[model samples]
Target: MLLLLPTLIGLVVAASIPPSIPHETLEVIPDGWKLHSTAEDSQTIALQISILHHHTDYLDIAHDVSNPESANYGNYLGAEELEASLPEYQRSAAEVVSWLNNHAISKTTLDGDWLHFETTVGQAKELLGADFMYYQHGSDDPVLRTRKYDIPIHLRDAIDFIYPTTHFMRPKWPAKMHLLPRQHIPTGPVTCATSICPKNLTAKYNITHVPADSNSGSQLGIGGFLEQYPDHKVVQQFLKDYGLRHHDKPYKYKVTLINGGKDPNIPAKSGAEALLDVEYGMAIADSLPVTYFSTGGRPARTPSQPGNKVVPRNESGNEPWIAFLQHILKMKSPPQVLSLSYTDDELDVPLPYARKVCSLCAQLAARGVSVIVASGDGGSAGTTTKDCKGPNGKLRFIPTFPASCPWVTTVGATNDYGVAHYSSGGFSNYFARPKWQDKAVSGYRTLLNGSHMAWYNKTGRAYPDVALAGSGYLTAGGGATYQQKGTSASTPVFAAMVALLNDKRLRAGKPVLGFLNPLLYKNEGMFRDVTEGDTDGCEVGSEVEVGFGASKGWDAASGLGEPDFAKLLKVLT
Candidate 1:
């Protein structure tokens, strides 16, 4: 049983500070956008102020807890302990709250490093020292944002950034498409079918067995965004179809609804993405308990009103991912392994927001959770046309986040044990490469030998860390079975494998593999290195094309390659 930490009382201090100074301009309003003078200043807007933390302290804790060589390995921190270790936030929070109180905005809530408060546009502009305006994107509704903002010099140390201020992070859906004419599901049991199935894939990868008793303590979490709901009925059918369910047994799993998350019963509206995630995870790790987290809030825009304008469906709370992270952090114990299939181009999200989300992943790692994210299905360049365009107006290879985040393990897609053409891979423009992957990435760079090198950031973090079968899988959704494909399929498959590994470790009286990169990089030989195929996409007419090819070692197309589960288990044990 995990022990919960008592909340510590924060001390509020009042200080006389100088007037605000001209701070850095975070984002510039796009060209040809005119401000709406009639836009309501009284419109209520909820803001999430992200506070800075002691970077070294958290990084040290993450390393010490994850590295097997360290004496502190497996000694994970509780939520309270993590909070206490970063004392910078406490002082910073008090100062910011005091400042807020003085501005007649005394009603504010603080959760870890996030300070939440509701303020009008007029008051927000006054507090942040900026002008708020409406900017139109395509035919979408005018989004309210500030071109630039200033924070008081004294309070700068306390706050890193604010969300919904200048950042626009759109959530991406799983990459699933119907099989081509040549592709078809086999007539026999899914396990014996030629197409990739849980049973066949597991057997081939040497992950055929998991201890039954270990299921009681092991849990796997699947994150759902954009209102995708995982129905229980569809999951049961999927399990039965794959021979994973007992004849008379009913489907069983936990459902956590965060911020109005829903599990729609209707087949037409029941999300195929959610169904694929839950079914694959439960089918792969049959014994382990699965928790489907249906997180709420509109991660993307929806068509609304007159003239087909696009607008956010939920504007009441933080972004879906942020809210989901906060909810998990507040728990006494979060799932050891979490699989997220949603992602967006790294360039679409502002630097500060990306860093904040990545920092939260680091925090999750310190507490023993292994975050597995899809590397995306946009090939070498990201899915967006505008986002892929470089500063020089040339099409460049773009990466996705939080796959590009160094803390989380990213899984790419493969078809029949080879790299899939649409599997997204590349280096990040915002984040630098972490020390753990330096040698492998450096080797890849040497292999490239300056070929297409100018299209990406050489020092940026490279992905993905692993690959798995991502195409020609049968999935049940909307009351019917269909073939699906994408790195979305690979992520859950890899996560379930990790969950099984954790179960084995626990049964053997060992700690779960927390923050997989350290162990993964150290034991690269444990995996089946994929050396063929390439990711192809991001075409800009006849002049430019973007993609990366598989190589002998770790390459952008397929990381260290598919996991050889039996080998991985033997090595870890």
Candidate 2:
């Protein structure tokens, strides 16, 4: 009966996982638990605290919903400033963090808040310190619906432990990130992909994908996101021209088609995102050089009458999504890095689904898989283009999804100077910090002014621990590789780097640097901090703004800064 425990644990872990994320074997649960407190109280229930809960977007920047720019920006806005910006309930987040640190809580190690998991139920009056606003969980239990603390939580287990297997942008010493012209297309010929790759010289290594963009038709591209952006048509053509095809290449590449938002069982209107993802899959696949593996079914789309045929179901927060992707990649073994350009905004105390996915991402990282993600195109305000015909016909400035998932390496976009504009940033509505941001400062400089805080009240690190090129001149495929912009474009670039690192790691036989947070934060030399500038506008429009300045350390806009590909390559290699 005791030996059967491992099997039971695996089954529970698998059943609890979100559909899109992967599930690994379970680690042993510790024999005992510790009791910690924030030492504060309020009307709302505050069980646990964290910034950008899960995914690491910058924390909320507003003091009130009425003011988008009200809250202070630099360095968590300082203690005095934070005190003024938040209500009593919100300010408790700082106290929670302060108490944990004061008590010497091991942030990323298995000893304390790290690698911790729990499920509790009670009223806001029963949990941590405050009675946070009653956020609905679509659950029947009054506790979950009103003030129940059915919190399914986990934390970094080591003072410098990795997020199991998640990651994205972490620069190297002498970090200096830059971009080049449209280099290759999704289906072009294969011939020395590394040749003339920009940001490759004067340091380590650099990586990227082939047939950069996807498309097969002239009128519309495969993916909804690509077609939505300008210059997509040109990118389609570039993929046709430069990218090497599997037939044209000597090396082999595998593919996995993910319709994470699929929901035929639901209405199209209900699953519109799934519909959009269908096209997204085809578009992405068409632009690539390898064959996309599938579950023997076409990409799922939300049916109408209820189906937003153009969109699919919203599975942006599923764990099996990433897990399945990894399972499909099956590179004889897991790669050192995996890049995913997905995100979500609803993570603070993740929905049942969010918890499952977070666990999967964490497990993968523990086994050594670097997950890179896109912060978003909304800039610091987080713009969301929702299908508003039913409730919101117009797009709103809401946080994006997936990118908000804490376990994956959340990435934001940046311009040359390293400041940010509209590139999305803020705290999570669902998850919490998973260790990794902890690092000692080197003799380097950056834009941000203070150390990152781990808490939930007020605002927390919503996203963008690191940044990359997503500006004026980058390439993609409409049918071939061409140039375009947006955090979308930026996402793949980082993914490619992770891939390159994987290529190197697999050759070395080292644990593929599983769960990269600790290493990333501890290794400040891998990145070049961007302490100036900010984005303005959407990817299609210019609204966010960034000043042209270069400083040291994290900045309000650019966070820890951008990548220095040269340094990045050296470190990874």
List the pairs of residues colliding in candidate 1.
141-310
Question: For residues 135-157, could you state the per-residue lDDT of candidate 1 as single tens digits?
Answer: 55554445556767778878877
Look at candidate 2 and tell me the lDDT of residue 55.
Answer: 29
Candidate 1 ranges beyond 4 A from true positions: 1-18, 22-38, 136-142, 179-194, 214-216, 245-248, 299-317, 391-395
Candidate with maximal lDDT: 1
RMSD (CA, Å), each prediction: 8.3, 18.7
| lDDT digits (tens) for residues 1-573 of candidate 2 | 999999999999778642321211112211111111121222211122222233221123311211213332111222233334322332333433443443334342121122321212222223222222212112211111222221213222111111211111111111112434444443443421433113321122233323333221111111112112223234234334332233242222333344332212222122122222222222333333322222111112222212123322232112234335434223333433555444434422124445545554554443345566667665533443322111122222334456666666667777655554647665554555433442322212122333222211123334566776655422333222223345554554555554444444445553244344444665567787676664442222443222212346643345466666556657755
In model 1, what lDDT does residue 487 have?
A: 92
* CA lDDT of every candidate: 0.77, 0.36
Model 2 C-alpha RMSD vs. true structure (Å) is: 18.7
Question: In angstroms, how far off is 250's CA in candidate 2?
Answer: 5.6
